[model samples]
Target: MTQHPTKTPQFFLTSPSVCPYLPDQQERKVFTHLVGDRAPELNDLLTQGGFRRSANIAYRPACETCRACVSVRILAEEFAPSKNQKRVLKRNSDLVGTLYPAEPSSEQYDLFRDYLLARHAHGGMAEMSVLDYAMMVEDSFVDTRVIEYRRRGPDSFLTGEGEGELVAVALTDEMSDGLSMVYSFYDPKQEDRSLGTYLILDHVRRAREAGKPHVYLGYWVKGSRKMAYKIRFQPQEHLMPAGWERYQPD
Candidate 1:
């Protein structure tokens, strides 16, 4: 065997695991590290190429027989919140969002654990310990931020940060064209407000306010209700063979 450069990117495959979105299905992922010298630029390019980052690894669903994982990005300037989206906005009007460094707090971990236990009890991440949570939040080579969501207090208007308990959290990345929402979780108990959708909507606004052009919404797995909500944020773009293609949903 010939010696090779250690800097050359190496990819690895994860053993088959239970698929979270589909029942009786197994999922496998092929991933590579997104670190070293060019992480930020690599992240932006891979994002356009349909990859999402978890920790410092950039990956997409690499299922052999399935092509359900389609990457979705919102045309932030052209996006119009539907009536239902507006309703969600109205319902969550009392919540405030604050962006901070990618450092984990016990408060956040409590909400995260509760979100997993209450909402994804049987999910793989259900067993993630606080150390695991810290690794999730802190492992990154590119710019990443955690946006904390909380209910507004009576005096919040007078100050800025709210007083209510944390209700949602979005681990997001600031990209060249927009902000990519890597993952988001919310208080399942507040199901009526649709906090997840509200979080994405808030990111779109944040992207626009920051003068970004789109909001990368990771993967939209067909027939997965968990991923389907991504479509309603139109006019959106989907990665196509020819390149980014604008689409109108039925």
Candidate 2:
């Protein structure tokens, strides 16, 4: 019998760039390709160590002077939605989210473009082309899925499929322990619905129904207004030097 040797993933460090979440700060990332036969397992291990997946790459902030980016995961089973979150859920009750295999569609790209233009016009992904969007959605090696939210039709209960126009979409990774929301976008026109918060609430529900323990919300940078909403999901655990510890917000 022949034994196969274990292969180690090659990690690389990115050059410093302007930090998108904070002003007057430089950001660097330590990343590795999540590919090959061991990609899923590697992804789980790295994610536990504070890495987040983007397509086929797993990266974590490696800023030399900033320790603000903290990995966060909601304790789904213990999560109790606040009044505001409940209101968000009620607002989106007419919408239904259906999970689909990791595949790209022109509809998804259109919404993504509009979202970037409206909310993150100067962000790094603002200029992503259709091909770039496709790569972002489909170029993953681990267990990934795209959740599409649309208006519920009369027959939706029977078919488990949403009808009407696409309102939002979330690119998610199914992990051994829970689901990781890699990226999410919604129709900018429906800002009043607070679709972003609805998406997170939906994921928490999904994780609970699936008997998953956590729902990874990526990095929450302290003092970053844009990331402050992440802290709203309470009973969450943050990756600390001693391992994941319960976060106590002030």
Top-TM-score structure, candidate number: 2
Per residue, candidate 2 scores C-alpha lDDT tens digits across 1-250 of 1122228788889999999999999999999888877889999999989999987888999999999999999999999999999999999999989999999999999999999999999989999999888989998888999999999999999989899899999999998999999999999999889999999999999999999999999999899999999999999999999999999988
Count: clashes, candidate 2: 0
Cα lDDT for residue 241, candidate 2: 91
Q: What lDDT tens digits, residue by residue, belong to model 1 across residues 158-194?
A: 8766677899999999988899998788887888998
Backbone clash numbers for all candidates listed: 0, 0
- Local accuracy by lDDT, each model: 0.85, 0.93
My TM-score estimates for the predictions, one after another, are 0.91, 0.97
